[model samples]
Target: MVNRTNRTQPLSGRGAGTREAIMTAAERLYAEHGLSNVSNRQIGEAAGQGNNTAVSYHFGSRATLVRTIMAKHGTHVGVIRMRYVKAAGDSTELRDWVRCLLRPVTEHHAALGVPSWHARFAVQVMTDPLMRTLVEDESLTRDSLCLTLQGLGRCLYDIVPPEIRPARAEMARHLITHTCAERERTMAEGLAEPGASWERTADALEDALVGLLAAPITRH
Candidate 1:
């Protein structure tokens, strides 16, 4: 799908620094406070842009800024996931494919370490009616992701109800996003569950997701 042209193109040369700064700051603030609460002026001030209009000049609108951040993280996650997908070639085991689904998320946030903003930012965009479509268009639908879903479908075969597969897939998406966001928030705040780490969380999530996907569908 052709990407819709961004209303505000990021500036080149020295202005690029200001643009990046605003994006980073906006992401952090938006993650800490809900999107509706954060404003362009606050984002501009947070980025240290003396000009109050900095965010307006750089991003045009809040939704545009949100999409930029989602695309940034989505690109990184997609690269790592594609590599995993390649490694899982022809493997029908549920765990092998589930790792492809879960690891990129946990691993990316893990690499970002504490105070990462993308997970929270993602949840916000997903929950919002308008912003959710922007994210799904730019980041969620991709050949690599579709390929992974195909692999999972192959793994489940005739076990899962075909009619209900879409419902189950959506459930899996919600679980991973919320779980990781909460984990990121607590870990950043030093409230992580008793010596827990992203690695351990990934393992636990992998186990649960595998069971969730592979569990037999009970027909009424």
Candidate 2:
């Protein structure tokens, strides 16, 4: 029996290009229309494939296709994160670790330029009940990300009370995901504010996240 999940393994030349096109179309459609709202056939059509089953042929099920896309972007982001992690060294500052955590993502989006769909697409996957686990699992496999997260944890161990850490962590996740999604959407629609460059946005996110992670826990 053939493993459909490994179908993309030997791609090259025209086959590789076709696979890339299908993934690109799927990412864009899933970003614009909700993941559940987009169909595999629609992705095929968007990718210029005449056969509606092109997506299934190339990537198997919806979960596999989504995982493939997430893996692509996640790998890219993880690579960029390693650069930041190296630069951070053994710095104990909370904001340095926060920068290590957030800048890779912002830098990836920034390098992709305006009108890119990845940030919003990631938010779509992260927020969806059925698909969220896929992203979480994907995240755990990234060594650089895990190290950065550990750095953040170490920085927060004394500052944030152990009991409320989980809640604050959840809040930080939402802030990073939704905030970047909103910025991407506004930029795509030409509604971004006067000074909305990715660097400035990253700085703002870094500030907010630093404060959020280090804020005094008020226990009544």
Task: Name the candidate that leads on lDDT.
Answer: 2
Would you list the clashing residue pairs of candidate 1?
A: none
lDDT of 1 by residue, 128-171 (tens): 88998888877647767777888999988877867877888888
C-alpha TM-score for every candidate: 0.92, 0.95
Quality of model 2 by C-alpha lDDT: 0.88
CA-lDDT, candidates in order: 0.85, 0.88
Cα lDDT tens digits, model 2, 103-201, are 998999998888999989988898888789977987887999888988888888778777887898899899999999999999999999998888988
Query: Model 2, 9: alpha-carbon shift in Å?
Result: 2.5
Cα lDDT for residue 143, candidate 1: 66
Q: Could you tell me how far off, in angstroms, the CA of residue 214 lies in candidate 1 after the best superposition? A: 1.8
Q: Pick out the ten consecutive residues of candidate 1 with the lowest summed lDDT.
A: 1-10
Candidate 2 accuracy as TM-score: 0.95
lDDT of 2 at 88: 84
